[model samples]
Every structure is written in structure tokens, then in C-alpha cells.
Target: MMNRLFGKPKPETNALQTLDKLNETLEMLEKKEKVLLKKAGQEVEKAKEYTRSKNKRAAIQCLKRKRLYEQQVEQLGNFQLRIHDQMIMLEGAKATTETVDALRSGASAMKAMQKATNIDDVDKTMDEINEQTENMKQIQEALSTPIGAAAEFDEDELEAELEELEGAELEEQLLQPTTVLPSVPAGRQQARPIPKRTAEEEELAALQAEMAL
Candidate 1:
């Protein structure tokens, strides 16, 4: 009972070995059957010869021996059939055992892998990946954001700023001179202002004017 409990079952190998042994036995049985058949034929031939020689008692004895040999041959033939049946069954069992062993190995490997990676570990790994992805997304968003993205500008302040720029541009335009002078004709020339003289020259000019009068 202890041996049975601790014994390793190699069903495939055992089945193959059993089949080989059965086949060897079958071969022996076939040889024996062939020999038996030959003996039976010889006895039949001897019986016929005795009958032809008119030895009736001798022919009957040979016929009886021939029947016994025939029975043994028939028995050997049945044994061969039984051996063939056992070999076929052992081969089928060997194939079945191998298939079962392969399935068992596959199931064991899958169970080992399942033990190595639990559902909780998978969930944790996925959660970490998602966290990293979200962090990277936030970083990208921060990089893509323009400067002062968070600062809000009032509409009134923006309008005032635009108006100031517009007013400054208008004042600069007003400070520039605007002239619209007409063009003079070439036939008419304007006289220049006369120079002021000294008092003696003015008196001399007056005396000359009196003398002329």
C-alpha cells in the first residue's frame, strides 16, 4: 500500500513496455501455432497413408492424434487473437496516457503563471501606468500653455489700453505742421524791404529835395 501511494506512474512508458512484451509473446505463440499446424497436417497425411494401405486401426489412431494436434493448433490461434487484442488495447492506452500527460503539463504551467501574476498585481500595474500617462499629459499641457495663461484681463482695461494708444497716435498727428501756400506768378515779383540809412544821409536827401523845389 505504501509503495502504491509513493510510486510514480509512467503510464505511457509502461503501456509501451506492456505492448512490446505482448507482441513478443504473440510472436512466440504464432511460432508455436505454426508448428502445431504443421504437426496436425503431418498427422492427417499419416492417417491418409494408413487408410490407403488398408490398416484401419492404425488409420484410426493417426486420425485421433491428428484431431488432438488440430485442437492444440486451434487453441494456439485463439491465444494469438487474444494477444493481438491486448496489444491493440495497450497501444491505444499509451496514446491516451501521452495525451493526458501533455494536457496535465499545460494545465500545471498555466497554474504556475497564474500564481506568479495575481489580479491585484495586474490592477496595480495598470493603475501605475495610468498615473504615469496622466502625469505626462499634464506636463505636456503645461508646456503647451502660453505665458500668463492664468492671468485674466478685464475687457474695460483692454479697451482703455487701445484707446490710449489711439489717442497718443492722434496727438502726434496733430503736432505736425500743415501748410497750404498758393504758387506765385512769374510776371509779378515782390519788393524786398529797404535798408535804414544814417541821419546825415537822410538830411542830405531832404536838402536836395528842397533845392529841387
Candidate 2:
């Protein structure tokens, strides 16, 4: 009822529009101030010319007009200062309002999300995820196992076979001929006294020489 009587509280004023209006007013005031200053300067010049003509009354009148123009210029400057002050205040208020609205929106969204999500639902989801992970782990374990890996083998027989193979390798190495070293080329050989060898050493050297052949 009170709102109806008051014709509904006027919608909040648009800060941007108000700021633009202030700016226009400030510009107009500045132009007026400039014009007034020019007129004041002209008046001063006229007063000077009147004084040069020896017309004291005319010079005093011109000086009075110059003072009036100067007063108007000062008033315009004050108007511009007021407009500037209002613009600064309005811009600050706009920024503060926007910041508050943003924070409110964020808080509301968070509250709605919290309302939509239930504790029981979260727990159920976590349980399903754990079950899936366990199932996947079992599947991976099954895939990693080799085919027929479960089959048992005779450990004793396997050890005996490995021993036999080792014995055969040793016998073969013992029967293999020793590698022979190459003799010095005749052209490169230096004349030196040959070292005497023992019977076993001479036999070994003879075997190596035959192997080289």
C-alpha cells in the first residue's frame, strides 16, 4: 500500500547514465567558464581603451563588467568541481555494488550445489568406485598370469637335468683345442736367443704350433 501511494519506489538510478550526465554538465560548465573568461579579458581590454580615451566613467563601467564576468567564471568552475566530485562518488558506488552482487551470486550458486548433492549419494558413489577398482585389479591380475602357469613341475628332476647340462659343458671346454698365438712375421722378427723350455712346456708349445697349422 505504501509502495502504491509512493508510485512504487523509483527503480534504482542507472549509475552509468548519471555519470554520463555529470560529465556532460561538467563539459558545459567548462565551455561556459572559458567563454566567461574570454568576455572578462575583453572587458579588461575595453576598460584599458576607455582609460586611454580619458573617459573615467566608461572605464569604471567596463571594469565592473569585467568583475561580473570573472565572478560567473568562478561560479562555473565551482559547478564543474561539484560535478567531478559526484562522478567520482557514483563510480565508486557502482564498483562496490557490482562486487557485492558478484559475491552474492557465487554464494547462492554454492548453496544450490550443496542442496543438490546428498551425503548418502556421495557415499554410494564412492562405494561403487571402490568396487569397480577392485574388479579391475582382479581382471588385470588374471590377464598378467601366463597360460599353463599353474601347472606343477618336478623340482628334483629339473635340478638333475640342469646338473647334467653343466657337466657336459665343462667336458666340452676341456676337450676343446687351445687358441694359438700368431708368430712374428719373418721380416719383422729380431734376431734374439731362444729361451729354453721344460719338457712339459715344449710339448705344450709343439701342440699349439700344430693347432696353428
Candidate 3:
């Protein structure tokens, strides 16, 4: 029992192999304990039979043997408990070790990535991106504008030309024909009715008289 519970493994044995060995030992110990329990029960039965036959000496001896087997069974049980404790501790240690190894690998990868990309490379890349964006914006602006939309006009010259046309229109309005009356002899200078003439009709009559002359 002691040898099984405190067994030594070779240096090359890993945690998994050790755990397997522990489990095998545990199973062997359990079987042995069960056998011992069966033997103890048989011994008790024998002691009862001897008691029925009135043999006090043989009954005491059988009881003594049963007690020894029970002790052995108890010891085997303790061994199994020790194996279980060992397995639990070993499993926990394995988990902790794996976690540490994974963290180390992740840190190493991150360090390599950081070393591969320096700040200068990052800044240069960003500058290139910005330059590309600006070039694209200029191209888009050129494509979106209509052709010949940027032709320039002189505002002052347009304003002066418009004022000249307006002044000529005002002068033409002032030159429209006016109403006229014929002269009377000095002895008959009394008031008399005169027909009203529209400005357009007066101008038409003047034009006809001039054409006649």
C-alpha cells in the first residue's frame, strides 16, 4: 500500500503520464479493498458458524482475522484518498502551467509585431494615405464641374453698357411730338375750341406734312 501510494516516477514522465499511473494505482487499491471487505464478511460468517457449534476458541480466531482484514481495507481506502488528492493537485498544476505558456506566447507575438512596425513607418504610411485622398478629391471636383462653366465676365463693363442704353431710352421719350394750335389774326384774337391731339397722331401728321413738302 505504501509503495503504491508513494510511487516514484522516472524524470521523463510528464504530468499526463503521472496522472495515468495514479489512476491505475487507485483502481488497484479499490479492488484490493473490496476483496478485503469480502474476506472480512466471510470471516464473520465463519465466526458465527463456529459460535453455533459451541466452539468458542475457533470463533475468537475468526473474529481476530476479520478485524485484520478490516484494518487492511481501511488502509487501502486511505491510499485511494491520497491518490485522488495527488490527481487533483497535478491537474490543477497542469492547467496553471498551460495558462502561463499561452500568455508567454501571446506576449512574444505582440512584441514581434511591435518591432516590425515602427512609428516612422506608421507616419509615412499615413502621409501617403493623405496624399492619395487629396488627389482623389481633386479628380472628383474636376469630373463633377460642367465644361466652360468657369468663363469670366467683366461686371463693371456690363454695368456701364446697361446705363448707356437706359440714357438713350430717356432721350427718345423727351423727343416725342407735342400738341400745336394755328395762329389767329390780331382783330379776332378771341377764345376758340381746338381739337386735342394724341402725341402719336401729332407726330404722324408732322411726318406726312414733311413728306408732302
How well does each candidate superpose onto the true structure, as a TM-score?
A: 0.62, 0.55, 0.57
- Candidate 1 on 34-133: residue-level lDDT in tens? 8888888888888899999999899899888888888888888888888888888777877887898899999999999998999999999999999999
List the global CA lDDT of all models.
0.87, 0.87, 0.90
lDDT of 3 at 200: 100
Best by lDDT: 3
Query: Which digits, one per residue and each the tens of the lDDT, describe model 2 over residues 1-213?
Result: 886786654223567778778888888888888898999999899989999999999999999999999899888888888888888888888889889888999999999998789788899999999999999999999898666744466678889999999999999999999999989887897679989889999999999999999
Off by over 4 Å in 2: 1-13, 128-213
Q: Give a tens-digit lDDT track for model 3, residues 89-139.
A: 999988888898889999999999998898899999999999999999999
| Per-residue lDDT of 16 in model 1 | 69
lDDT of 3: 0.90
RMSD of 1: 21.5
Q: Would you list the clashing residue pairs of candidate 3?
A: none
Q: How does candidate 2 fare on TM-score?
A: 0.55
Say which prediction, candidate 1 or candidate 2, comes out ahead on TM-score. Answer: 1
- What's the distance in Å from true for residue 124, model 2? 3.0
